[model samples]
Target: MSEPIRVCVTGAAGQIAYSLLYMIANGDVFGREQKVILTLLDIEPMMGVLEGVVMELSDCAFTLLTQVIPTADPAVAFKDVSVAFLVGAMPRRQGMERKDLLSANVKIFKVQGEALNTYAKKDVKVLVVGNPANTNALICSHYAPTIPKENFTAMTRLDQNRARAQIAQRVGTDISNVQNIIIWGNHSATQFPDVANGTANGKAITDLVDTSYLQSEFIETVQKRGAAVIAARKMSSAMSAAKAAADHVRDWWLGTTGTFVSMGVLSDGSYNIPKDIVFSFPVEIQNKQWKIVQGLNIDEFARGKLDITTKELLEEKEEAMAICNAN
Candidate 1:
């Protein structure tokens, strides 16, 4: 058996972490054979709550959970960690502009990024799960010069999963039958959930569903699913978000076999997306690395959609960069 690995999760007392910890502890993420030592971090006010969480973890009797360390200090939380889930960020409140929330999280992620650079393992993989996640991840990557740009990613798998489910439902097929559904650009409402190249049971999704609905209703539903969930549940998605995060890391560790999944990684000018900003694209996992799927025929309709979402990401990048420069 391989040695137990340390996994650090920020916002340990929050709803997402509440669901996330158990998944990792039960080997839902690291597989049944690999053991893990969980390093949990939150602010001082949340530490008491975090301790309760630790107690619950201890009570679970998970054979794969070798240790659970709760701390308020970033340095302590991050020390020698292999996989760091930067899941903690300030949520946007009523009457607040998106830029206002971005500024607050910029400072928080900058500090955490510095901590990761100072204390984490050389090849630590960072996944930003908080709101404004793509920008927060870009800020974190900017601050941590030592960590490779490719190692920093934001969670768009949630959007991808939602898109896949929506497509499957529209076509009256099993969810597993939908493949290669792409979520391009940001995690917000502007995101384009494209099924142009997707398949349902080895057939093109466009052939299965009406083109008009695919362009209009399907796109809107997948993009706004989070808000719809909050409207119905009075709370944001937690369990599904946790599951997507786990699947993302799992696919990155294992391989995706040329299957298309969405990940927001710092772009290298692929698909006409500018560099230094993290953007979601149709990607395949191989050799423990993700590469953008190339040579897709983007028709005029897809181009127009990509332009809108790309513009939003560019504006968000400017806001995050302005905050970083000012600080």
Candidate 2:
């Protein structure tokens, strides 16, 4: 048999890690044909939890899983890694400033980036799933100057999937029928889920549903879905988030040649988004890299919303830069 593909996940003791590890071991993300060796990375305090997770993986008796290694050090965890998921982050507490959150994450990402640059395989692909994912991804890409910018992306696929599911429910149709829905701009509250271009079973979403209702209520629903889940369950979103992260990376590496999906990628000034800032946009993955779906004609309304989301990304990028420079 050939060598197993190495997959490294940071923040392995967190809730999402719990959901993600099983799926990976079962070949949910990388496929059954691909044998995997899992590397779980976490902080020193969480190393014990990671060990427990590894024990569970061993119990599953998954033949496709070659090995599981848990570590607190990025250098060791990322060594020869084929894929890296940056999932551990400092969650923003109530009353904490956004600047503080950004700064804290920057410190973490900077170290990871340097480690990845020095240790990971040349073909390693990175997905940032932590909060302020776009900005965090930018920091990593910037620090790893030799890695291609297209190799670093943040997870906005969750937001995209959320929008699709909400639209499907509203239309009384299955999610598989939904297409062309775009998650524009930041992955945060400012994300613009453009159903204007979306279709359900070849029917325009706007034509089937009330455009005004979608613009007002539907958008808010998709944006606040995370909060709603937290309110109901008294916990952060983990399972769905993990699933989305898996989908994001799977589609990226596996290729979305004909289909478009949303991802936060380093901007090349597409749609006037500032260069180097990781912003969400409709993209198609080909040739092992993400290429923004360019040349789409944006109406006035879409343009306005897109600008709002891009502005937030730009502000966050500036904040991170300022904090890094000051320190």
Candidate 3:
């Protein structure tokens, strides 16, 4: 058999990983034909939890699974991995300010990033799934200087999926038919879910939906969908999040043709976004590399929404950098 690809998942014992690990092992990200070696990472205290998770995986006896390595050490987790899901981060506790959450996660990502730089394969493709994901991705790439910035991305695919579903429901079409929805800016509530250039079954979304709904209800629903899940379930969205995370890396690994997906990649001054911060944009993947989709006209309404999200991202950048500099 060919050598199995090494894949690492941080926060492997968490709720998200509980669902994600199976998908990775059972050919959700990599193709079913591709063999995989899974490396799972969690804090020392969560090692017990990971043991049960591993046991379940073992019972499944996946034909494509080659190995599973569970560890608390980042260096051990990252070493030689070809693909990484940086899913672990300090969760926001009650009474914690936004800055506090950012600060804690910044420290965690810095350590993991440094480990990734020192041990992970040079070409490792990383997806940041933790909250404050775009800024966390920035901090991770900042510490992992050897890994090209393009290799680090934040998960905005969840937002994109939500937007597509909403558009599909309103227009009464299969969600698959909705294309070109863009989740612009941060992974936070300030992110803009844009359908300005989107189409549903070869027809413009604008032509089907009035501007009032598009400008208000549709935008807010996608942006606040996470909160809605939390309010109803009394916990965050895990199953859907894990699914989206898997879909994200799967698309990135295999590459997408004739369509684009939303990903938070490092900005290179594209579409008036400032350079170096991780901003979500509509991107097309080819040959395992992604290029941001260009030439979509940003009208006045779209430009204003973009600016709002951009401001939030810049504020997030400043806050994260301040915390990093202090440490």
Candidate 4:
């Protein structure tokens, strides 16, 4: 049998993790033949809840399951883990300002980052799934100096999946028909879900759908889809977010087969995006590494949209810098 892959998940008792844990155990992220040992973490108060989660995982009788460890200590949870999902963060509550939210989460990520630096495998692949994920990832990366910055990514696959589904619906086709859709910038309202360079059933998306709707309604819908889910479901998106998180790590671990997927990775000055900012861009994964898809022409409209999102990320970095750098 192959050696077991150590996978760590934070916020193990939360909604997204509730949906995500089973998928990971079932070999949805790692391959079916791969054995996995999960190290799950949460706050001390949530440790009992995490224990219940472990009990459920035990009941599943997954053939590839090796073991499950539940703990409140980040160091213990992260130790020797090859893949770490930094899925826990402070959620935005009613009446909480943006700065307050940033401040709260920055501290959480800072501690986790330090623990990861001290404990996780040198090549650990970390994906931040929590809200304001791009900035949270930035803060985490800033503290984990031992881990390669490129190994740290934020989840933009959710946004990309939403964009792909929207285009597929507009074109009256399955989502499998849409290819190369890009979710650029932060995973916020300013995110640019571009379909201009994408295709639906081997034809350019712009040729298949109304350009006006693509630019306006389609963009708005994808940006606000999370809020819409919250309003209708009385909670934030759990299943889709969980699935997206799985897909994000799966594609990064396996290769993307020369396809473009959206990932919020540290900027290397590509498209003039500032270096070290965790920004989403069109990328192709190969050899377990991501390279930004280069030389794609950005029209004036796209440029304007990118600028707005970039400005927001920059402001977020500045707002959280004091907290992020304190470690």
**Sliding window of 10 residues with minimal summed lDDT for model 1:** 249-258
Compared with the true structure, all predictions reach lDDT values of 0.90, 0.89, 0.93, 0.93
| Candidate 4: pairs in clash | none
Cα TM-score per model: 0.98, 0.97, 0.98, 0.98
lDDT of 4 by residue, 65-134 (tens): 8999999999899999999998899999999999999999988998999999999998999999998999
The per-residue C-alpha lDDT of model 1 at residue 267 equals: 89
**Tens digit per residue, CA lDDT, model 3, 87-188:** 888888889998999999998999999999999999999999998999999999999999999999999999999999999999999998999889999998
Give the TM-score (vs. native) of candidate 4: 0.98
Residues 222-321, model 2: lDDT tens digits: 8888899999999988999999999998888778856679999888889888888888889988766778888787889888888898889889999999
Candidate with better lDDT, 2 vs 3: 3
Error of 1 at 186 (Å): 0.5
- Quote the lDDT for 297 in model 3: 91
Clashes of each: 0, 0, 0, 0
Q: Which model is ahead, 2 or 3, in terms of TM-score? A: 3
Kindly list the per-residue Cα lDDT of model 1 for residues 1-327, writing each as its tens digit. Answer: 579999999999999999999999998887899899999999999989999999999999999999999999999999999898888999999999988999999889999999999999979989999989888899999988998889999999999999888887777889988899888999898888988889998899988899889999888889889999999999999999999999888888777975888999998998888888889888888877888899998889988988998899899999889889999
Off by over 4 Å in 2: none
Regions more than 4 Å wrong, model 1: none
RMSD of each: 0.9, 1.2, 0.9, 0.9
